[model samples]
Target chain A: MKKYLSIIVVSLFVLSSGIAFAYDGSLIDDTSYTGTITKIDRGARVIELTTKFEKTPKTWKLNMQDECQIQVMTTKDPSERGAFKKFAELKEGTLVNVYGWPKDGKWLARKISILNPDDYMVKRLEADAKAGVFFGHEP
Target chain B: MNKKGFLALILAVLFLAGTAEARKTEITPADQRDWQVIAPQDSDTPLRDYAMLYEAGGHDGNIGVIGIPSMKPYRYIKMGVDMHNFPFSGSNAGNNNGTPDGKYLWVSDKGADAVIELNLQTGFAERILANPKPFGIHHSAAMSPNGKYIFLTGELSGKMAKMRVADGATTVIDVPPAPSAPDYPDASKDGKYVFSGNYYHSAVMVFSQDPFKFIKEIPVGKNPHGTNFLPTNRWAVVCDKLSATQSVIDVRQLKVHRVIPVGAGPLHNQPDNFGKYNYISSFVSDSTCKVDLGRMQMVDEFPIHYRVGHNSIAPDNHYYVSQNKFSTGLFNPTGIVFAINFEEQDIDELSPTYGKTVKIVPINGEPHEGRQIFSTTIQRWNTGTGGDLFAKGYELGDVKVNFDEKVPGKGLTKRPSLEPIHLAAAKRYFIPRDDGKPGVTQEGDVTVVRVKAFSYGYIPRFIHVKKGAKVRIILTNIDKAAGLTKNPDVTMGFLPAGYYGQKTRLDGVRGMSAVGEFVADMAGEFEFYCQQFCGPLHLEMRGTFFVDPPGGTASLSVGDYDEISKLEYQVSDPSEREFITGGNRLLNTLKEGNEPAL
Candidate 1:
């Protein structure tokens, strides 16, 4: 009975690990934002985005780490997991929620999730309000 | 008037008149005439040497030939036009470097999947090689050192094509695998191997030219864009755009020799005439740096305008031109968009004006790539050097689409109709769905819409999708079948106002289709339109992309024309004083001949 229990536990751990790294892998304890990609330097693998979190539209240059996890949402549900994609597939004008941390005085992207068009309106407005685009909505 | 002696004058007046007539007839010598005074070249204004700048046309689909020093337009080579055997546009230039002999130039027209050969001596297209499908979207046309073959990169196909120049026979080679976008391809100086920069990965892929097989991948910085082989034949430099560095590869050993740090976005690499110094153009950093090949270290850096896309060193090593990608706020705002400029800097160390910007030449379109050739190589119209294009039996007007063995049936005048296929795919959108929303249907998980693009407009002008639904747009260009626009290369993009990005843009050739899928995250109306300039009504080639709120549908009814008329009148409000006097008050005062108040 003891051996069987240990085997079951090991199986559970392996399955979870597989799921975690299935669509690339994300860094632990990183801040995330949903923004529109404004510019891209394909050679540098860096992107300039206007995040919805600021009071004004602030351009943020985020460099993708070599091991950064990238996924694209394939379903209408924002929470649904999507397929893995290469860094070259990411194009300008894409709406994405990026998880990143500050490293070496630069924004290092850990994971990038291309957002679904269905959720764009709410997120865009939320970003607009945070950017203080509306009167009396200053933050 | 010399009625000199008014009375004695009857005879004297006649003599005076005759003398005046003679004086008027007497002319100055032709050589002594004082024409428009142009400053002559002196010690301070030494006459510069001559060179020809061949710039790849970004949107205009023409190669601009400009004369150096004079800063004058020489002529333009039209690509993928009626002038060429293969008629198309939206030319995405690969490399502007002429053949080894400098007799021909190879450029890629991505829209047509054809690489055009331009005769440098004749200024006319010599041939068009339609690289077969699955080897499409050719980006670079790097000619071999022997000038016998041209290597090309298919960005979307993830493949590299090697075409024999003599017979135009093309052989497709797989790059690596999916996720590998081979961007710039170049042949080794010794012509033994070919190298391609993998845009997706941080490595350069090498292939043996003789056997045309993959050799190995050399690890480098991320997003290696351009690979330039030095004249030394022992070393090659790869611009790692994303890594902000350049990697030097030892061609003899086929390994990375050094990775030198550079400014952000090192895009293109150009070696000076002697191959001692390499010029790296940092696009995002808006600067260009010179690296000493011996030490593999940057020696000097010069600041340039915003976003230099491509740079070229003069053949004589006297000047450097940085082709800035953007001109926003750099020049006078004339309400016109796409105004670009390139800066020319003196690089000669012995010159007193070295390191100074010699000229800032404004161009109409973007300079995708540029090559500087010594003036002695090609004869110019100013020199009346060689056989003119007209003398070679080239027509000024559009030639009839001709079929050739090199590219069979590629220049077809009529394209097959895709209407039946489009209509069938669009049927699902018109039928009421389970949710009672017409023109929107959820298939399993995502909502799909089929759209057809023609000249000046898109079918189903309004595309409505529910908020929170994933939307996939499949766009097809029917311009060739519709025969509406003369130029049929149309790209439709789902772009909202002030939004930047070409990710959603679907580029298509006539009778070709493209697909773009994304989540419908935003609610409210966006716009979809032809991104490429097609004709006079290009701006009108737009439609509404409506994202309705969840469980709510947008009102698509125009109701009546009277309602729009009333709305327009209500907004006009002619009673406002500003409406009647809309001209600038200062301009009005000036027109009345009054000094305007400060």
Candidate 2:
């Protein structure tokens, strides 16, 4: 009976260790994503955002981790940059910039920053207009 | 009869027979013979009534003449000048623009940095107006309607000059720096304004002809390669190379009025003598688009089998002749000439045989700028004082005669020898591909096959042969005629790494055939396709050439073939994918947005 119990314990420990190793591997090769937040699920610690890439709009879902750093830009001054903030402060309809690594079909966020939504949205619209003209389409 | 009487009669018969034979073999001096004179005829007579055609040899630096309708072999007239000798002279001889007086032909000598005037009758260069600047590449010449002033564009210097014909005085006018190379120059019918097309800039630089002053720069499409003005419509049509559109500018307003889309790589624009239709030839599309000036719309688009450089319309307005420049990939030089019959109201009414084309190799190289030498222009030279100058031992060669009787085959035909390909080692070749891997063949024998290329596709798309075999590919262009009369402009290219010594074998034009012989020194699957931009579906015109091992059954299956049998010829639009990417900044900007502060 003791042998079987030891076997079960070792198996659970090995499986958990594998899961940890995979999570650690996912932390490597970090990239960045910038977009407007479309949805936020606090319970799941997940945020869905729409980003424009190559004049093509794409949606990405990111998971917030415990060590993820957050910052917010509240001033319009070009030199002021941004100040540190909390992940809980992020909300839907807010413009966000994220840095993370992708693994197991999920984006693991390591850093998040909040931007001036109105300014970024206007810039995005202007870009879309220019793209439309280049593609022979009326915006 | 008595022995003496019989001998006398026999001697008389023999003498008569020998006299007849001598007359038959007598050779006539080319200059002494009076063939069809280029003298002016009745204006009411159609241009097709003329018996000859004149073409400018682009690299060859000679003017070639051939029989019209008969489509005979070319007879070359060497442009000999003392200032410019044969070995070191005649670099980049561009378009032949006729002088208003018809006594001389003006051509830009790019290498000599001079504009040369060739006397029409003597075939001798009468004057060489050297460019003051040493590095200027003289490209095109335009004569003032009054016939007193000659205008020329220095393509490399981005400058235009007006020269007085009487005294050879030159006044140079500086214009905006042409980022795109400046090519052809055209003058208004009134001779008030001259326009130069910037090949890379997609703009036309306008100037006052008399004073040689820059007036304005008018923007058109991407890569405006050719420009021509229509006095009847008071419009100038600019052929945009990359944009696949023709920008029509109001000559009076000096502004673009409308842009009509055309085939890809439109290189030259030639308006018919009547000013009813404007024809544009596309380099990449292998087709010619005819724009009806009356309706201001594209009426017809027809294939020319290869990239056409410069075109000339017959004065009688029965047909127009266009010369081929390069193969589809712009890698190989093509010396094919197309004679398109425009008099037929419908394509169906045109003859596929006699009315199509003749293949003639240029004297020095491929023919480029072509201009129709009207009978009126020739007559003026012959009857006027110009004839006296020509009579002084200036005429060079004779016009080619007996075209129908001397040459065989109709439409597109093969040359007697494949000398062009044998001279230049191919840069691309064909290898085999099998099961997503390089095909391996064990065979050591040579394999020979014939391939027929058509619009957007090739016959026997999948070819199976052994490795290390001497392979001979006989290529025939069997593409259907565009509409009822025009031959499909198409060329076949074979591609494989390290095959044919890294050379590409591309030959055959519409209605013509070429043979490619190579030792199948390597084994593998290679891809073959139409090398020239045949039409919109050109990308889909491809096939597989499988080289299998002697004992291997590694043949391409139906599932393995990328079948494009259903594709047809189409005009390709400019791709805007790069613009959509926002000039290589979108990806960087997106990444920068996620960068840590500062």
Task: For residues B551-575, write the lDDT of model 2, one tens digit per residue.
Answer: 7743323211122111100101222
Give one digit per residue, the lDDT tens place, for model 1 in A1-139: 9999999999999998877545221112123444689999988989887764334444678887654545553235322333456677778888776654454567766456566545433333455455443211111
Model 1, TM vs. native: 0.49
Docking class of 2: incorrect
Q: Highest lDDT, which number?
A: 1
The digit string of per-residue lDDT tens for model 1 on B251-322 reads 767899889999887888777633456888887667888886645688788888756777776644557888
Error of 2 at B356 (Å): 5.8
- Interface DockQ per candidate: 0.01, 0.00
Off by over 4 Å in 2: A1-139, B1-51, B80-101, B177-180, B327-364, B376-598
Q: After superposing candidate 1, which stretches have Cα over 4 Å from the reference? A: A1-139, B1-49, B81-102, B334-336, B380-598
